[model samples]
Target: MAKTKKNVNEMSFLDHLEELRWHLIRAVIAVFIAAIAAFIAKGFIFDTLIFGPTKPTFFTYDILCSISQSLGLDDSFCFNEAAFEIQSRTMAGQFSAHMWTAITAGFIIAFPYVLYELWKFISPGLHPNERKHSRGFIIISSILFFLGVLFGYYVICPLSINFLGTYQVSDKVHNDFDLSSYISLIRSSVLACGLIFELPIIIYFLAKVGVITPEFLRKYRKFALIIVLVVSAIITPPDIASQVIVAIPVLILYEVSIFIARFVTKRQNSKALKNV
Candidate 1:
């Protein structure tokens, strides 16, 4: 379906802004309420989810150990606990970390509702046909986002924490990591993957609008692989193994996005032919 011109829309600028305000308000309320719920479940969040990666018995570590054993490498990478300690370097550091962590957790948990609000705002500009086609937007995007978050938390963050937390140039150089640093690692892992997982949605929109195409994605597939590996290397441990582990899933997602783009274009062609 054709999109309405933004400037020619019935709503005036002020009216559009007002409409946007309501969407933002609803989104904020959703996040805030979810955060409060997460805050009340402090034990589960702080110990079970947040700190689980630091323990050797964590599922990620166990999987890594098994992989290492198969490769004839010492499973030293699978540790019972990270050798580093998290400390608060400032008076308000611990409290600040807690508050922000809760907020981020809230945002993560409230992601679906947030997407719903966004879709509500954008849907008004779409044709009725387009709106109908987008019926599953919220569910599909939310599932992809949560899957990415789990991967980051369970796979990427744990590997990173296990590796960085243990790396030492000298015995004297202790790994007394600040609370803020630890939280940053976790936050980055969660948020980065959350955003990255939206690639399919992005490609969908781009393909829908004719900006990106299946052929374009296919033409530069090798280049995309390099970029994905580089991105994985940036966000993960230095080891090739870790980088490959992270890159593989992202590459697969990219391939899936290309297929989605192709399918969309094919459907559009079929529809156009039917109309003619």
Candidate 2:
């Protein structure tokens, strides 16, 4: 490790850029390799996972249906099937969607290794203490990302597909969605939620750098709630219940981020006092 550190320290700016280029190349290679696997497993990727939400017997639909039935509410969640047709208009549309979907899946599956490569590139510049403090960064970030992806896939995607699929302006209008549109919805939801779930990590780093404090987070709590609600509304069905369900977790994350900020600030202050 010391020898590796010495090599890093001796590297010129151009050499550093070259090293970064190699890391990026390796990351891209990892993604492409995973994409090949996904492409080979077309049935599982397309039928089992991507199109699961459009089916009536999807897990989220069944659970929500039971809840609605128990509560004697409207049977919005008890639909038979999503009232939409996905078609490829252009000649290469289906092929293009397939390749892109596999690539996106590849990136999602290979995210941890990509993060590792990125961490490797940056860790050489960090102090040993800083590196030690962030030992669990990759693992924790990966877990959060996977959780967010699951939530988006199981909850948000289903809700959006259900609502938008059945929506109709008139009897004359049909909901024939483009194949790319459907894939885009799933991809965006999963990726967006994955990144959003890294809130605590982002806050911790910002606090460590003295950019934000817990007090700032507490002061802006109300604004954060409003923003969460808006985001929830955007991602979920028009129903208040769905919006509340989505907002609850995000609000909890915000509170957790505040706590993380507080912890980082306290640690930094203690270290400063020790140095004095």
Output the number of the TM-score-best candidate. 2
Model 2 ranges off by over 4 Å? 1-9
lDDT of 2 at 103: 98
* Local accuracy of candidate 2 as per-residue lDDT tens digits, 134-195: 99999998999999999899888988898889989999999999999999999999999999
lDDT of each: 0.88, 0.91
lDDT of 1 by residue, 123-161 (tens): 888988989998999999999999999989988898899
Best by lDDT: 2
Residue 120 of model 2 has an lDDT of 95
